[model samples]
Target: MLTRILPPPGPARLLTVITMVMSLGQGLWMAINAVYAVTVVRLTPGELGISLGVAAAIVLLSSIPLGHLADRAGPRTVQMWSFLALGPLTAALLFVNGFWSYLIVSSVQAIAYRAGNNARKAMIAGLVPKADRVGVLAYVRAAQNVSVAIGACLAGLALAAGSVPGYRAAVLFTALTFLVTGALTAMEAPVPPVPASAGAAFAVLRDVPFLMFTALDGLLVTHALLLDVVLPLWVLQHTDAPRWMSAAILLVNTAFVVAFQVRAARGTGEPKAAAWASLQGAGCVSVACVVFALSDGASLVPACLLLVAGALVQALGEVRQAAGSWTIAFELAPDHAQGQYQGTYKMGGDIGKMFAPALFAWLVLGHGALGWIVLALAYTGLGAAMPVVVARGARMRSGVREVAAAGN
Candidate 1:
């Protein structure tokens, strides 16, 4: 049973453990950070919003450069240093008494977090064979979900206490997890640095087709905001379901992802298979939107049922989309520059995340059911377009290779 749950005693296992540890901290922080900022730290909502926006901008701008650094200076070393830095930065959050201090701490924390994540991706690509990358990552994701759930439960205890000391303890616990994960990260097998070449530092920027695909994938990834940002508010404001149902919806999604992400990732090692999975995932999410729309005017029982059904569909979509996206991100990039390429790829998701909450709030809270219909249409369009984008990217790469061969 343990073997099935964990990778054998190797770099894969080490990475999985690192993910679990890191996710535990993330779960704790995510659950209480907003409340802490508002009530404990005494920052207004606008200040909190500004701080998050700044952090997002930092992530978008810093990811590629940090990834490039990983490619040049070995992924393991870069990742270890990033994690070490993150421990201190996250610990600084306890000292954030005002808007400026919070902004500075959060932005720096975001940079360290982004750098470590990009290096981890590069390390995975180096350690795991292409055929097994997605499969291994799937297991890691499941482990992450499980760890995060446990961390959230721990956070719940702190929330129940509702004391400043309790909140501080949660932050301190999260900081300790980062420090432990950093120590664990140092144990992974080292991946040698990719030698840098003149004029090739930003080659991923020239890959227009890949950029387009990334953009589309980013848009589709907004399905996350639907679940995290929009759904709870929708249930509370527009539907007849009890307030507790919001938490139940998230529990349902978490259970499904933990149970089936690896199963959904199967057969998606190649680009074509991955593309199909993306489309399927998108369709499911779109259908979920329609179901959610139906819940708007439903009675209590039917509304709860519809929300649960929507969460299940959304979870399936989330798993399949994640599997496909990981495979495509790994398979499409040149192995020599996986760090930079992955960083560039990550920027797309950052953009989506930066805009999604506001966009979703307007659509769901402002416009209600019609907003869901528009979201459904948008998701379907993006998913349907992925196959063409992937094909175009492949063709462009093939052409570039042929040209280089002729020139040689």
Candidate 2:
């Protein structure tokens, strides 16, 4: 099982281990970040939100240009530098005493992280074949999930020690891991050269059909919010089930993802197949939403059952969407321009992250039971629309090839 899941013992496997280590550090820092910020950094909730919002905005604006740089300079080179920069930038958070310092450090960290992420993703494309890309990505995702779970547990121990010092230790640990991961990544094989005709820097933006596909995929990515934000709020506010059920939902999600992500990715090597998987997954999510809504009026036993059922279904949708999205993104990208194209593809998720929290909060919490129904319908529509968009993109790609052949 280990041999099958991991890339053969070489750079690929090393990269996978590096990813796991990095995720562990991220998990540790994230688990303690809010508490640390409020207690140690002396940041208000509003200030924290504003600072993070600025960082997200910076990442959004810079991702494409960084991706273009990766395509031009090689993903390995870009990744190395980004990681090297990120270590110190993250460590600088230790000195953030006010809004200005926090904003500057966090913004630069966000840019560096986004650049590294773009290059890392492109490097995956470089390292793995098209047939194995989704599966390999699934393994990486599973590793991240497992590492994060462990890291979170470790962070919990640190928090138990005391808030201020413990949180600082966690952040410092994260900074050190970033440095280690960067150094390790620098030793990996170099990225293959890009073809000369990979088109202009932002050419991905001109592909209308691909953009539409990305937009729909972005909407689908909101399943993340469903698990992370919406369900927790909904369960606390609407359901008669115990509050611990919120934690249970996350546990179920992480467990299921770790167990079945690679299995779900199987047979989805093509964009059309992946799109179909996404649609099917969306159906599961829709059912979960309806089930979750029904829990509002039920007694303890039934409500618990409903929440569990809904969470399980939602987890299934999460795995499918992740696998499908990876396949579509990789398959659609031209080899020479994968870095830029993947950067653009990543923007879909960033857009979803930016808007889905507020949207889901308004829909699920503000509007009550009716909100869940609305969300379900919206997901269904997005799922149904994906195949059409993928087909359109296919036609467009084929047309471009035909035109190029004619010119030849």
Clashes of each: 0, 0
Pairs of residues at least 3 apart in sequence or in different chains that clash in candidate 2: none
Tens-digit per-residue lDDT, 187-292, candidate 1: 8889999987623998888888889878988888889888778988898899899988989988898888878888899988988889889999999999999999
Q: Please give the lDDT score at residue 334 for candidate 1.
A: 81
Which ranges of candidate 2 are over 4 A from the true structure?
Answer: 1-5, 193-197, 402-408
What are the TM-scores, per candidate, against the unseen true structure? 0.96, 0.95
lDDT of all the models against the reference? 0.89, 0.84
Pull out the clashing pairs in model 1. Answer: none
Candidate 1: deviation at residue 268, Å? Answer: 0.6
